[model samples]
Each structure stands twice: as C-alpha cells, then as structure tokens.
Target: MTSIQEKIIALKHKKNALILAHFYQTMDIQEIADHVGDSFELARRAQTATQPVIVLCGVRFMAESAKILNPTKTVLLPAADAGCAMADMITPEDVKRLRAEHPDAAVMCYVNSSAGVKAECDICCTSSSAVQIAKSLQEQRIIFVPDQNLGAYVASQVPEKEFIFFHGFCPIHHQVKPRDVMEAKNAHPEALVLVHPECTIDVLEMADFVGSTAAILDYVQNSPKNEFIIGTEMGIVERIKQTIPQKSVYLLSTKMVCYDMKKTRIEDVLKCLEQDIHEIDLPEAEMKGAYKSLERMVSVR
Candidate 1:
C-alpha cells in the first residue's frame, strides 16, 4: 500500500468511517474501499453500515442514495461534480406527467436517477435486479424511466407485462454500435460476447450473454470459457483481468469508459476523509419519499 492509502486506512479507522465504492471506480479507490460493489449492493451496504460517517467513491446519485438510506450518518462524496449524464436526462416533473398519462401503470425508476426522481416512482431498481423487480410488481403496465436500453432489456425478459419507456440512455453504453461488436468478434473468434443491458438493443442482441456488471464478473469467473469480450465500462475489464488472470478478457469497445465514474481519484478520497467536505444533503421530504421506493426495491427477493 502507498503512504496515502495507509493514511486513508488510519483516518477511516480513527474517524469510525466506512468507505464504499462502485465497481466502476479506479482500482486504487476500490482497493481502499471497505466494500466494493455495484449500485444495488452498495445501497444495501449503506443501509446496514455500522459507522457514523460514510464515504462514497462513485457519482453524485450514488452518494445521494447512501444519504437516503442512512439519514443520520454523514455521507460524503469524494467528487462532488461527478454526476451521471443519464440521470440528468429525466426530471421529477417528467415522472409526474407520465403518471398522469398512464394512471393504471406503476412507476419504476432506475437507481441511477436522482433522489427526487426516485421519490416520484413506485419502486427503484438496479440493472441486476430490474427483471426481478419488474416481475415482482403487481401492476401489468410499468412506466420505466432513465435508460430506455435497460428498460427494453427488462421488458424482453418479462413478456407478461407492458412497459412504457423514457428516452434516456447511458451516453457511454448507448454510443456502442453493432459494428464495434462485429470487429471485436472478428478479432477474437474464441471469445464469448458478454454485454451489459445498458447497451443499445442492436449491441445487446449480438451478445452471447447480457447482464449487469456484477453478473458479468460472476459469469466470467465461473464459466468454462477461456476468452471473453466485455461490453460494459472499462473498469470491469480491469477487474476481471486482475482477479481472473487465467481468463483472457478483452474490451468490446474502446468508448466504454465512463468519464464521471473515473473522476474520483485516490487523493480525492483522502481529502474527503480529512476535511469531511462534499457531504450529501437532501430535503427530509425527498428522503422520506425516496426511502419508500428504495425500501421496496431491497425487499424484492
């Protein structure tokens, strides 16, 4: 461990703080994190945190979720400006308007959205739990928000229900064209194509496997295949290469990196722990409203 990492560990222990990180974060940040997971796993971890202070090394929305889950604990975001572009594409007003149009449908917002957006929805879901959450809902008509690509993917799996989708998408994943997949496939004929549902349908259809980041990681670790093409954020490729060195992993597209997710550096985390800067604050009303949706999300088996 570096000097800075040692300091972070000391400060974390002294301050009685827990550091949580998303899989999309840089390796250094992930190394120091007490728990490293995707959005759903991180949110669940935040809910059960025993520390008084929590440092989240992901985007603004993730920090907000931590704050919502643990209202009393101080939640600090290392990079305050690291916001998700797709989360900003939809608003609470848009959700309300959609609710008016489809009164019979239940609203479901992706965990990538803001607290206000989640407040307006009936339940929240992450990429990994979307299909299960949609299936658990009693309503036949579901209004899915903030990532039409993921919504469409879930809809395909849950054919018994009807879905009304929003137009938002992950700029990074959405930009992946079908040709990119073909090029990667042609280059590595032995590699199995594994993609995230966040990618465009055209890209997803060509994949041999489609799942969330954690699911993809688990698949690669357990699969008998020796070589694989990863079609998500670049961080997952790094993680796979580091953990499963025996398996050959290749990034399906060079454009899969998320700028916002990479904004948090090792120094930023140290600064957050030292100064307690960039704390997340949301209105109590918003917290109360979003909590219901988030609670429902976690309850789904």
Candidate 2:
C-alpha cells in the first residue's frame, strides 16, 4: 500500500474511526471508506457504528447529518469546503417565512439540507422515504424545502397531500436536459433509464425507475436486465462497475458530475485522518432540535 493509504488505515485503527463515503464520492475515497453509501445509508451506518470518531468522505451536509445522528461521536468532513448547492439554497428564516404563509402545512425537509434547516422543519426525509413521510403527515398542505424536483416527485406519488415546494436543485443534476436522456437512450436502446428524484420532471418522465442513490444501486443489482442508463451523479457509474462488473451501465449525461462530491480526494481523506481538524460541531440546542426531525424520519422507516 502507498503511504497515504497505509497511514489512513493506521490512523483509523488508532482513532477508532470509521470512514463513511457517499456514492457520489470518487472511487479512491469509496474504496478506502469503511462504509460506502449514499447520504441516508451512511447516516444509518453511522448510527450503528461502534467507532468513537466518524470521518465523512462526502459533502458538508452529509457530515452535518452524521454529527446529528451521532452526537457523541466526532464527525469530520475530509473536504471542509465541499458543500451542496441544494443544501445552501434555503435557511431557517426562509422556512419560517414559508411556514407563516401556510400555518396548517407541515414542513418536510429533504436530507440534502443543513442542520439549521432541519431544526426548523417539522420532519426530515430522504429521497427513498420522502413519499412515505409526506403521506404519513396528516397535514393537507406540505411545505417541502430545498428541492422542488424531489417535492414534485413525492407530491405526484402522494397526491392526497398538497405540496408547496422550495425553489432549489442540485447544480449538477439540474444541468441534465430531457434531450440528453433521449440521446443516451437512442445510443443504448436496450438500456433501462434509472433516475434520482433530484432530476427534473422532464428527465424523470423518461426514466423507467425513479429513486434515491441507494435505491438506484439496489435496483441495478437486482434487476434481470444487464444494461442501464444512470441518470444521477457520475460517481455512481464507478460504484456500479465495482459491485456488478458484468453489467453494462452508461451515464445519461457526462455533465452529471458533482464537483462538490469530487472535492474530497484520497489525499484529503488521509490529511483529515491525520490532522483530525474540521470536526463538525453543532450547538447542543441546534443538534437536539435537528435530531427530532431526523429521529422522526428514522422512526417512520
């Protein structure tokens, strides 16, 4: 093993740290991670981890989530500057203002948001659980924050619950146009289109399957078909290749890359493990408040 790889492994053992990487993370980071998954899956794994320190090989919002889920454990984001546009799109004040406009509506926040936004919302949800969470809420009107695409998708599924969506989207996924999906399908005629809910409605309409990153991975693994056109971040293609090398998978658009997710390199992971700086620290009250929404999400699942 190289020095960086050897040192990271050594430090992880020494610090009792478990590295959690998102599906969008680079292949190197994913390979070194003790657990590699999407945001919701990583958070779930972090909750059950026996390690005292958790290193997140993902974006800032993901690290914040790990901190919220494991308050007692130290959560570190290898690339401190790595942040999601969707997460930064809304704030606590914005949620409050929207809440005022629709007093009877429940606030259901996507997990791609920040700790502060989660604290303000009534309940938090992931792409996989959004439809169920929104449906479970007794409120007829729901204010879904920080991703209109996901909100719209969930609203379509649970039509009984009316949704007031927030104007936010993943900068990377937003670039994907419907024509791109068409072109990809034209090239790979037999391939099935699998898309994430963050994708635009136009792209979603072209998809044969719609779900979260974890859900997408699971679909590709279990499906009888051997070919797919993935409609999310590009990193997932690498992940799928690793998991099921025999299957053929193609990206709907090459522009589906998330620079924020790629920011956390193997070098950053090694440096983070060695220095142990950039630890995620939420105020006790902030953490406690956010935990309620997140905890409620888990309970429903």
Candidate 3:
C-alpha cells in the first residue's frame, strides 16, 4: 500500500504541482504541502505560482479563490465537501438584498465566503488584512458581510470607520466559552493566550494576542513565553508542537475542531491527486468580477 506522502511526492513530480494548505488541515496534509497559510496568503501565493496545478488542502471556497486568481492553472481540492459554514451563511441573493436596503454602503466581503458572494462584493479581506482593507476604503460606509465576529474585531481596531455587519459567525470559534478562557488561564498563568479574531468580542477582550492563524504562528515563534493557549482549531496545536518542541501548547477547549476543515483526509487527497478529478471551476464572467474584488484587496495591501 502506498502512503499519502509517497503519492503526494509522486504527484508533485508528475504534475509540477504545488500543494497549498490551510492551518486547519491535518498534520499529515500540512507536512506534505508545499505551502501552508491562511486564505489571503494562499491566494497571493497561488497568483504568482509557476506550477501547473494547485492542490488546495483547505475548503471549497479557498480552492475557488485560487481558481479565480489563477484562471489559467488547474486548481484541485481534496474533498469537494470540505466547506466553511460561515462562508455558507451569506449568498449572492443575501448580498443583493442587503445592498437594496443600504444602497449607500459598499460591500467588503471576507475571503472565506463563496465565489458567488465574493462576486457581489466591492472588495475582499481576510482576518489579518480586514483592518487594513476596511481603512483603505473612504468612498462610502462599509457593509462587512459573513463573519460578524471578524467584522466587529476589525471595527474595533479601526473605529474611525463604521462597518455595518451581517449577522453571521464561525461556529467553531463562536462556541468557545469565557469560562474556558478562565480555566486555561488558571492552569497556565504564564502562557500567552493567542486567539483568532473570528472569536466573539469577549474572547477577543480576554486574549493576550488577537490575530489570524499566520499571525498566531509568528507570535508563538517569536514570543518570550515558552507556553501558550491557542484559541483556534485543534490542528494548530500539532503544528506548534512540531515547530517548537520545547514549548507547551494548549487549546482553550477540546471542542475546537471544524468538521468541514477536517472532512478532507489523506486518502481523499491522494485519490484526488491520482485521478485529477473534482476540479473547481469559476465562470469566466464570475471570475472576472471576483478577481476585481480580490485585486482591490491585493493592490491596496
């Protein structure tokens, strides 16, 4: 029986492929990936890649974004079902309705959303870049759609600008209770608490550091503290452990897994690579529209 790693290496050579993974992917997938980052960083990397294929190890929307950016290159996802619930919250129809209500506000969609939703947006942003993107827009009031927690977090950071938020959130991050924070703090008083801004405002308030997955990785790598509590997905703990063998990492809660992110496994990835099946396609017209939003984000940042 061939291991997934062996197959991945074979596929890389055969197809001249680049595997881009998300932080929420399994440790095995991360180990096999050529690049591992959040949505924004991965999209940027995909845009400049010389490779013919981009094997995205994240959710469906992420692969769709890669397809939108690198229209010429073939983009494949391990599992078509791997998706984000937060991204699923808002649709193009929902955005149209919201725009009808507030014609004056410009839509700033989060990259985690579907391509159809992104096509409706004036610009797009990730958790790390949301503040900067929101600040760049001075033309009109901003309606930040999808993840309200992220929207609120960006709003707090850039209070000079007002953001009208859609009532939506990440279920995994939203489930983190304040009591979990207190408990983790009680257990590891010296450990720094690194959090994802997709968490609720109260959780953000309790965090010693509130940022994206990439930012959290950088912080843990550079922080003076030898111990930390991570408030994102559980997969991150494995990555931290592998990188910083001496340090201790804890999850704020054991229930931090995103089933959607976990849906794609090693076997699924290998099958997709071998068959070159389940390709993600963005309509030429929709790609053009979505790329405009994405480009506005890339150029401004």
TM-score of each candidate structure, all chains considered together: 0.99, 0.98, 0.97
Expressed as tens digits, the lDDT of each residue in 9-32 for candidate 3 is: 887889899999988898888888
| Model 1: residues with Cα > 4 Å off, grouped in runs | none
Candidate 2 Cα outliers beyond 4 Å, as residue runs: none
Q: Give each model's whole-structure lDDT.
A: 0.95, 0.90, 0.90
TM-score of 1: 0.99
TM-score of 2: 0.98
**Cα lDDT of model 1 overall?**
0.95
Candidate of highest lDDT = 1
- In terms of TM-score, the best-performing candidate is 1
Clashing pairs in 1: none
lDDT by residue (149-256, candidate 1, tens digit) is 999999999999999999999999999999999999999999999999999998999999999999999999999999999999999899888888999999999999
Per-residue lDDT value at 167 in model 2: 97
